[model samples]
Structure formats: structure tokens, C-alpha cells
Target: MAEISAVKEAWEIRQRFKPEIWFSAPGAKHYENRYYANHHHSFVNISVTGEACACRCDHCNGKLLQSMVGTPTPLEMRRVVDQLLDKDCRGILVSGGANSQGEVPLLAFMDSIAYASQKGLKVLVHSGIISRETALGLKAAGVDQVLLDVIGDQDTIHQVYHLNQRPEDYLRAMLFCREADLNIAPHVVIGLHYGQIRGEMKALEMIREAWPETIVLVILTPSCGTAMEGLQPPNLADVGEVIAKARLTNPNIPITLGCARPSGQYKRQVEILAVDCGVNGMAYPDEETVIYARSKGLQTMFTEECCSLIARNV
Candidate 1:
């Protein structure tokens, strides 16, 4: 009952403002919104590590990498970029598994990222906890955007990601990105603690301090081959509360629901809540979500691109 009240309060608060609904699902995602829309052949995700991951975090255990295009080396990444360009792809998300220390080995690909940017492809990187030097290097390389997952609870970091770093370390990383003048996006996973809500609002408060160009909210979606396969998923109402708090905290910043989250009926409910909470955008939304948003007289648009690109687009 408390959860329902919170959801209703947030929904009412959000309806007082005009909201925009964005649908970004790259690589052949097709949907209809007054017209047939598809995102395939325009945007793609590339795994810089192929299938290799060191940390093998409890939630993922590297299973997420299987969905990305594997590009294990700088040359391979560049080659893949060429193929994507040939297909007239608009952008690419360069991501990979992190090392044991929660760092993705992205330094080696700096030159390739610069090359891709020079070739007119929008490049975004999922760089984990990185050094100041790396942040500056990414800025110099002209990478379009950088995504850092911010965790507010130390236990969540240590137990879930198995990292020795503290929550302050994540804040410091965001500071480095800001110092480097890079377009940075901070992602807060709503239910990262084994499908339980933990410190998510605190994470948002921390991001408010940094004032990033954009913020992304993604929920924990347990994969079948991972340790958390049978774990209970996050509650839709709780996820809605986080989104509402984020809206209250950073009214001017673009808030988006990223491509990762629970699916089926849960996804529909959560997406609807996100819209009601005044989120700026959503990634890979269902057809019904678009219809719902339209029914509420909200502005809606679709792109065959990444949700992070919403910052650049706006």
C-alpha cells in the first residue's frame, strides 16, 4: 500500500509537467508510431573484448557481452567501424567486460575511437572506473559520450561488482570526466542489489552534485546463464519512485530509461511509470508504451539509436 501511494504521488507530480517520450532501439528494432519505424542498420553495440571479461560480476558474469559485436583489438574495432559505415550506421556504442578492478580496458582503443569520430560516426564508450588521464584522453579523442555506472552504496559495489572501490571513488571518476570536459552520462541501476532497491536515490543525489549532461536509469534484468538467474526482479513502483526523485533532483537534465531492464509485463509497467514520472526518454519501448504516451498527450519520437545519444540530439 505504501508503494502504491508513492507511485500515485509521483505520477501526479509528473503529470503537472509536459514530458517527452523517446524510443531508441538500435540495430533492426522495428515499431510503429503513426508510421513504420526501424532502427536496424543505423546503430549498433560493439564489444571491445569479444567474450573476454575479467570481473565476471555477480549479476552479469559476462553474459551480456554475447549480444555485442566482438572487436577484440584496435584493428578489429576499426574494421568493424568500416563495415558499419558501409551500411550507413549512424553511431556505435563501444563497450566491453571490465577487469577485476572494475575497469574496462579502453585506453588501447582511444586511437580507434578518434579514427571513427574522424570518419563521421558518433562514438559512445562504456568506460568503467578510469583514471584522470584516460578521461582527458577520451576528450582528446573526440569521443561523443562516456557512460559511467554510479553506485552510492559501498556494499553494492563490493558485493555485486566485487570491487574494492568505495562510492566516493565513483564520484571522483565523475569529477575526472567533468574536468576533462567530456560529455558524460551517469547510469544508475534501479535494482542492482540482487533485484532489491538499494541506495538508488542516493546514487541520484550524488549525480546531482556532478550535474552530468544526462542521466540514464536501467533496472537489473537477470540473465539465464548468470548467478542471479532466479532472483526476484525489482518492483515497478519502486523503480517509478526513483525516476520521480531523479526528476525532482535534476529537472533540467535529460533522464532516460536505457536498453537494459526487466521484460514482458514488468517492462510495460515500468515504462509507463517512467513516462508518468516525466522521464525525457526510453530505450527499446514496446508499441503499447508509445500508444500510452500518445494517449496522455505527450510528445513522442523514435530513433534507431542509443538512448545516450538523446543528450546529443537535444
Candidate 2:
């Protein structure tokens, strides 16, 4: 089913435009019987709260956080950093499960963040809904980038996030990052409600107003244990539409198809469409798109650093 769609979508992409994409999947992948693989940036989320997120959002079943490296203490964090440093890591996306107030307890570990920076690890954190005070702490700690998932609608927030947050709360969080002079990279999950496109465009507009340095477009992936397991992800056409809107809205800003989007040709088609839509760059670009972009006019490059906030210089 996906292969047939990819064939059709490829013709559409060639007719419209060719955009750059990066593939961030670990191990290996093949699309339409052609090998697609690349060495891209990798992140070790040294989680402080393990898999226990407070929000328990409708789209995520608490399975995603389990992939992060669990580190509950400063010493444990240091150990993880030490290993990543030895391996010459480009950066780490320090993240964890949120607490009841929609917060990730990363502020308390400023010293650990500082330690990682001192050892030459560029650190980016996925914070929960935050206050100015917390943002200040992250800045003082030398965090290279800070990422937050921002929902645009109150219904999505209430129904999906199961929290009492208004959409404005997400705006406040974006400004908090802005005021602290940190590189802000906000994520807007596409098809967050069983693969629906509700509130996605609003999320893009919020990003434009915030003027974030980078935006990550991670889509919803179903987990078997969650309430939404039986639900399907939003269609590639819908997600592609949102990505095109985001690119047109924020032309210069970098947009990434993060590692969390739906798999198979849904991944390839959305990624290929991302390049067509004028995304500045992608974190883990698909191999076919990379080859095609080079064939067109883009100067495709690879780096081991986190794809979200890669500086314009490189």
C-alpha cells in the first residue's frame, strides 16, 4: 500500500520541487527495494524521570521515553556524558518525563549540564511547560538549545495532553526561551489525535510569532499500550501540507522531521515532500532525497550533531 503511494508521490514531488531531507532512523532501512541509509546525528536523552511522564498525552503511550538513557542523579548523568564524550558525540538532547505541573526536572541539574558543555558536548534539552525562572537556569547552565513540544489548541491540550494548560501557556514557554537568549526549537506534533491534522497550522503560526531558531516537526507514532493504539497516524498528504505551510511561513528557519514520525513509506514521502516545501534542512534526511537534492541544487552535508539547532555556519 505504501509503495504504491510512494510511487505516485515521487512523480508529484518531481513535478513540483525537490527539497532536502535527513533520515534519523537507527540500524538500517530500505524503501521500494532500494537501500537507504546514512550516519546522522544521534541524541542520548539522559532522563531524570525515566518513563514516568505526568501528562500522559493521548498520542504518546509512555513508550517513547523508555528509549532514553535513564539517569536520576547527577553522578549518573556524568557517567553517561563521559561515555558520549569518549565517543565524540556532537550533542545530547537531555529529556525526561514531565511532572504533574507539566515540568521536566532538568533545571535542578544545571551543574551537570555545565559539566557536559565543559567536556564539549553540545546539550539541548526538551523541557516541559516552563517558567522564566527555569529558562534562566538553562541559559546560565550553557545549554546550547532548548526544545519544547507546543500544542496550538486548548481542546488538543485538554483532550490530548490531559492537562489544564491553555494554548497561551505554550506561548509563554516560547517567550521564556526567547528572553533567556537560548536557541529555541519547538516541536509541533502532526496528527496528534489518532493521525488527525487538527491544530497543526496553529502550531506553525505560534512558531512564527516566537521566531524560534529551529522547528522540529515530529509526528505521532502509535504505541500498543496507549489509548490511541488502534488509531492510525494522519495521512502523509495532510502532514505534507502542514510542513509546506511551516516552510512558507518561516522560510529561513531550519525544520527537521525528527526520529519519531511514522515509519515505512509514510516516512519517505513526508521527508521527500519536506524538501520540496523549502525546508532549510532536515535532521535525518532520507537517502533518496539527499541524492536527489544534490542532483538538483542543494549542497547536502552530514554532521553528527543534533539536527534541530545546527548553526547556520555549518
Candidate 3:
């Protein structure tokens, strides 16, 4: 009952501020439905490390990098950017596998990143446990935003991510980005700790301290080859509680249901709960959820950009 009331209160709070919600379908994934079809040729994702990851975390094991365009060298990255420009791509997410120290090693490609930015492309970097130098370099390259996954449990950091670091280390990365005056989008993965809710609230607290521009919440979708391949995701009630708490914690922040998560009925239910929890936007929403949002009197808007870019109206 308390959880129910909290969700209702969150929804009410959202209604008081705005009567609209956004659904995004970035080009990272191919999506089409009755309500909206995404032909987002203007956005793309690039991997600087190709298919390599020193961490090889339990949930991903570098499998996620396979989908991105591989540009392992500075010249290759520049070449890809040129090709994207020819294709009329306006934005790119520069990400790659994390190293042993849990960093994405993006400093080496700063010149290429700047070149892309100068060429009129919005750049967002997924920085894993960044350093001060790398943070400043990203800022210098004119990167529009830095995305970090804030983990609040030391065990999750050590065991799941195979990082010889503490929760404070993740917090320090956020602080580095903050000090660089970069737009920080912190992602809190629900069920990150093997389908259980551990340290998520603490993660949220740390995000509040960092003054993030947006909070992106994603679910742990078990991959086939990873250690957690068969694990079930967090239950609906748990997902709802976290979403509601996130909205309540930052009433004015643009919280988004990001692109990662399970599909099928779970996806539909999660999207509905996200709207009820007053999430500002969602990525690749189910067609039924779009209707559900409209029935609740929300003025639905659609976009082909990443949900994290909602604040900039990309």
C-alpha cells in the first residue's frame, strides 16, 4: 500500500509540473510500431575499443560492443565520422569497453572527437570510471554529455564488474565530470546486482550529490553468453518502487527510462509504470503504453534521439 501511494503521489507531482511525456527510439536499435516508426539515420554509436573489454563484466562480457561501429584507432574513428556525415548523421555516442581500471580509454581519441564535434555532431561519451585528465579532455573536445553508470555497492563493483574499486570510486568519476562542467547523465541499473535491489537507493543519493543533468534508469537484461544469462530481472513491484523513488527524489530532474531493459510483456508493463511514476521520457516504448499514456491525459511526444538528450530537445 505504501508503494502504491508513493507511485500515485509521484504521478500527481509530475502532473502539477507538466502534462507531457516523450518517447524516444534512437538509431542504436531498430524500432517500429503502430504509433511511431524510427528512421533515425541521424544518430549512431561508435566503439573505440572494438570488441575488447578488460573488465568483461558478468552482465555484458563485451557482448554489447559488438553492435556498435568499430573504430579502434583515431584515424578509423575520423573515417567513420566522415562516413556518418555523408549519411546525414547528426549525433554519435562514443563508447567502448572499459579497461582493467574500469575506464573507457577515450583520451587517445580526443582529437577525432573534437573533429566530429567541430563537424556539427553531438557527441555523448559513456565514460566508465573516468579520470580527471580524461574528463577534462572530453570537455575540451566539446562533448555534449558524459554518461556514467553509478554503482553504490562495493561488492557489485568488485564481483560483478571485476573492478578493484569501491563505490566511492564511481562517485569520484561523477565528481570529475562535474568539475569539468560537463553535462552528466547518470544511469542506475535496476537489478544490477544479479537481479536484486542492492545499493540502488545509495546510488540515487550519490547522483543527487553530483547534481546530474538527467537520471537514466535501465534494467539488467541478461545476455545469452554472460554469467547471468538465465537470471530473471527484478520483479514489477521492485522496478516500480525504484522508479517512483527516483521521481520523488528529484522532482524536477528529467528522469528517463533508457534503452536497456527486457522486452515483451515486461517491457509493456515497465513502460506503463514509468508513465505512472512520472518519468519524463522513455526509449522504444511499446505501442500500447503510448496509448496508455494518452489515456492518462499526457501529451505524448516522439523523438528519434537518445532519451538522455531530451533536455536539449534533440
Candidate 4:
């Protein structure tokens, strides 16, 4: 009952500020429903490291990279960008496997990224633990946003990510992006510690301190062939609590339910809770959730771009 009241309060706070909600379906995956169909080629994802990853995090183990377009070299990245442009692609997410030190090898492909940005592509980079030089380079390349996973617990960092880094290290990376004046979109994965809510709230607090352009919350979706394949996702009530607290803490920031989450009924419930909790946007939202938002008298809008791109307009 207390959790229910908290969600209600959060919704009220949201209504006081922004009454509109946005649904996004990026081209990374095919999505269609009664409400809308995704633009199959509007946006795309690229992997600079191919199927390689040094960290090989327990939850992902580089399997997610298999679905992305492989552009390991600068030349290949340029070629892929040109191909995407011909397909009428409006944006591209340039991501790759992180190294043992949790850094994506993005510096080598800066020129290609710049070329894509120059060609009017909104470029979003998944920078794992970034350095100042790389941050500055990305900013110079005119990248649209730098997406960084902000883990707030050192134990999760060491155990799941297999890194020697601490929570402060993640904070420092955000500071680097801030120094470079790059638009930061920090992603906090709920139940990253093997379906346990270890550091998500702390992660949200860190994001509040960093003052990013947007805050993205993704629930853990145990993937096959990974260490967490057999694990259950976090409790639905807990997921709602985190989303509600995120809304309450950052009343005006654009909080989004990102694309990485569980499917089926769990996905449906989370999407409904997100709408009730007052998230500004959602990625790949369930069809019924869209109808529910309308039933509650909330204005709705749909976009074919990544949910994080909503911050660009804000």
C-alpha cells in the first residue's frame, strides 16, 4: 500500500510538470502493433569491436553485439554510415564491447563518427568507462550523446563486470563527459547484481549529482548463453519503486524506460507501472500500455528514434 501511495504521489508530481508521455521504437529491433509500426530502417546500431569484448560482463557476455552491424575499422565504419545514409537512416548508435578496463575502443573510429554526424546522422555512442581525451574527441566529433552505464556499487562492478574499478570510477567518467561538455545519458540497470537491487538507488543519486541530459532506467533481462540466463528478474514492485523514486527525485529530468528489459507479462506490467510512475518516455513499450496512458488522459506521442533521443528535444 505504501508503494502504491508512492507511485500515486510520483504521478501527481509528474502531472504538475509534464502531462505528455512519449513512446519510441528504434530501428534496432522490429516492432509493430495496433497502435503503430516501427520504421524498419530509420535508426540503426553499429558494433566497433564486432563480437569481441574484454570484460564479457556476466549478463551480456558479448552476445548482444552479435545483432549490431560490425564496423571494427574506421574505413568500415565510414562505409556502413554511407550505406545507412542510402537507406534513409536518420541516426546511428555506435557501440562496441568494452575492454577489461571497461572502455569501448571508440577513439579509433572518431573520424567515421564525425563523418556520420556531418552527414546529418544523430550519433549516440555507448562509452563504457571513458577517458577525458576520448570524451573530448567525441565532443569534437559533434556526437549527439554519450550513453554511459553508471553502476553505483563497487561489488557489482567487480563481480558482474569483472573490473577493478569502483563506483567513484564511474562517477569520474561522468565528470569527464561533463568537462568535455558532452550530452550525457546515464543508464542504470535495475537488478544488475544477479536480480538483486544492489545499487540502483545509489546509481540514481549519482545521476542526480551529475545532472545529465537524461536518465535511462533499464531492467535486467536475463539473456540466454550468459551467466544470468536462469536467474529471475527483479521483483515488479521493486521495479516500480525505483521508477517512482527516480521520478520523485528528479521531478523535471526526462526519465525513460530504456529498451533493455524483460519480455511478456513482465514487460507489460513494467510498462504500465512506468506510465503510472510518470516516465517522460519509453522504448519499445507494450501496446496495451499505450492504451492505458490514453485512458488516464495523458497525451501520447510516438517516435521512430531511440528513446534517449527524447532528451535532444528537451
Candidate 4 — which pairs collide? none
Error of 1 at 272 (Å): 0.9
Candidate 4 residue-pair clash tally: 0
In order, the Cα lDDT scores of the candidates are: 0.83, 0.72, 0.90, 0.90
Cand. 1 Cα-lDDT: 0.83
Residues 72-103 of candidate 1: C-alpha lDDT, one tens digit per residue: 99999999999999989998888899887787
- Error (Å) of candidate 3 at residue 17 is 3.3
Give the higher-lDDT candidate: 1 or 2: 1
Total clashes in model 3, counting residue pairs 3 or more apart in sequence or in different chains: 0
- Model 3 C-alpha lDDT per residue in residues 1-314, reported as the tens digit of each score: 22889999999778655677889887778889888887756689999999999999999999999999999999999999999999888799999999999999998899999999999998999989999999999999999999999999988888899999988888999999999999999999999999999979999999999999899999999778999998998988999999999999998788999999998988988889998999989998988989999999988898877789886542
Candidate 2 clashing pairs, residues 3+ apart or interchain: 19-275, 19-276, 20-275, 21-285, 22-284, 22-285, 23-284, 23-285, 195-233, 195-234
Report the Cα lDDT for residue 130, model 3: 94
Model 3 bad stretches (over 4 Å) = none
